[model samples]
Target chain A: MKNAVAAPLTGVPTPDLASIFGGFFWVGISGFGSALPFAQRMVVERKRWLSDAEFVDAMALSQFLPGPNVVNLAVTLGGRFQGPLGSLAGVVGLVAAPLVIVLVAAGIVARFADSPHVIGALRGMAAVAGGLLLSASVRIARPLWRKREPWPIAIAIAAFGAAAVFRFSLLECLLVLGPLGLLIARIRRHPTSS
Target chain B: MNSPLIELAVVFSQLGLVAIGGVMSALPDIQRQVVEVHSWMTASEFAGAFALTQAAPGPNVMVVALVGWHVAGLAGALVALTSLIAPPAVLAYIVASLWRRFSGTDWVKDIQSSLNAVSVGLIAAGAALITLSAAQSPALDVVIIATTAAFLGSRIQPLWLLGAGALLGAAGLI
Candidate 1:
């Protein structure tokens, strides 16, 4: 296992920093509302740098830690493909494009922050955002539903119920579900092994 | 505005460092801190701002800027925006370096798969939370549900949905 881990470190492709940087840049620019799912498809499904399993693993790790999942993915994927330098290129590329656009937009918004038209526009956009987020949730959940894992399904349901109905904090629900998920996984594995 | 600017930078920097599963997952936490703790905005107000940020083109983190701007002004927007995004960017740089060195192990693969499952759950929970918090009227709730259904049922581009929603909102239908 250790040797296999070391193998990628030594033999991983040394992609041109410029090219990788460009990829990250484009991803940042175009990612917008649905960028995350798109990026996952590009890297995991299209590029095959990491298998679906590996892609999910990286996402899990990224989410477990603090910070944006997309940015963490950039580091994990970039680092896996190249090295430390690759990660830097990836991070810079991912953030720079969006940062510039948002800053500019913020400037414009600052001028009209209180305008009725602007407010209306933002309200419309909010609905759209809600839609976009809903779509993202479906995309992420499809695979799990297909797998038909009862525990995961239950965990998802419980989490949703807790937050939506009971109005529990997300952190509280996560604290409850995270361990339950682990315990369930262990039990499932144990049954087969025994 | 100056104090808010400083506050924006400080608060969102903390948020950026802990915003797992994209900006959406952090919504609950941001609400808890900003609305519940700091009283920066009412919960509904935060939701409205979030809606605007989502409607705009760019990362969802742009909401930080909107909230900051609302609280203070342009300076507040800048501070919030920078703090929300910059720390994560820096962290990505560090993690990226270490990740490359550990890419090939089976354990790595296992970990990634498990995390993906968790993210799915987290994101789902996030959606539910937002829906509950933001949707006030049956009409508004219907719009949200319909939009979600449309996104799930078709391969239609997101921009179209956004455009249509904007049109409806402008027309006072939504």
Candidate 2:
């Protein structure tokens, strides 16, 4: 039942606090658009700390738990190495830049809230954001497409309609759609494949 | 009466606990609290904040900071940021340790696969919302499709795509 692709190829190599914090600090700073892939590159590619499979597994575990995906990855991966302190380092390193930048942006943008150019650029940025999100969706759903299953695909469409068109909040869609999808998967005995 | 700082922390920490399937999924609920429940900002303010944050660098969760700053300046910002991650970080730590230890176990495998499917649906839903919100003009539609195609077809870094998008926006194409 091994996933040949995206499988763990390495074991944990002890990384000290400086490396962990410094690595994640850069991840935060360079973490434009989405942070997950940056974190992935930092951990799995450059750091050689976690293999691809471990990163994916850690992501799935945290994705459903709470908070942001990359932040959860930071905390969880840091915990894997140095327990609570590691998690703390991960959070601080990943957040510090964004916190400061967002604060400054909030302050500055408020003063310029009525500028036509500013509004125009933000509108364009929003459109770009849409592209990023759409790319993320396709990447995540890529595996399900290969499996040739209609049910998970249906679930994806339903979930989309609920959130985007029907205007249901995400949790509302998940609460209603999650359990039913899980049940169907359990019945099929191969949940992810479908 | 409560200090808005305390209220910010309380509300965010509480939401952080229940904000499943990633924080993006929790954005609407957070908006509901800040705009409608807390009366800290108007609806348009909330939407603008969210839109700008999506286009910002770093983690997507920084929107919490923007909302807090809008509501009560720097203290509100700090409190909102802290509370948003504290509870979830603790839970994530425990779950990560458990998963690292028992991931290969049959029951663990089952749980992972089940949740993985749910994640797929949830992310797709989030994408849909982003698309609908971002799309306003035909030019923007072209930008969205081009960005998606470039991402799906090439190995170009997303930062480049975002930069290109920003440049296009600055030029008034989108």
Q: TM-scores of all models?
A: 0.75, 0.81
Per prediction, the TM-score for chain B is 0.84, 0.74
* lDDT digits (tens) for residues A1-194 of candidate 1: 12112122223444566756776676777765756776777665544456677666676656655676676677666665566666677777876666556656656755786776665555665666676677778887787788877777777667656655665665575567666676666666567764
Task: Estimate, for each residue in A34-146, the C-alpha lDDT of model 2 and write its tens digit.
Answer: 78878889988888877677677877777757787888888876766776777788889999887888788777777887877666666666666677777878888888788
Q: Which regions of candidate 1 deviate over 4 angstroms? A: A1-13, A37-65, A77-86, A165-171, A192-194, B1-10, B13-18, B72-118, B132-139
lDDT of 1 by residue, B1-174 (tens): 346667777788887875655677667667666777689987666766666555545567766776777788767776877687668766765664466466656555434444455556667666665665657656667778788888888987776777776677666665
Cα lDDT for residue B163, model 1?
Answer: 71
Task: Return the number of clashes found in candidate 2.
Answer: 0
lDDT of 2 by residue, B1-174 (tens): 488888898889887886776776676567567766788876545555766676567888888888788768998888898899999888887676456567666555545455556567666666665566667789988988988888788878766666676677767766
Q: What share of the true interface contacts does candidate 2 keep?
A: 0.63
Cα-based lDDT at residue A24, candidate 2: 92
TM-score of chain A of each: 0.72, 0.79
Which 10 successive residues of model 2 chain B have the least lDDT summed? B107-116
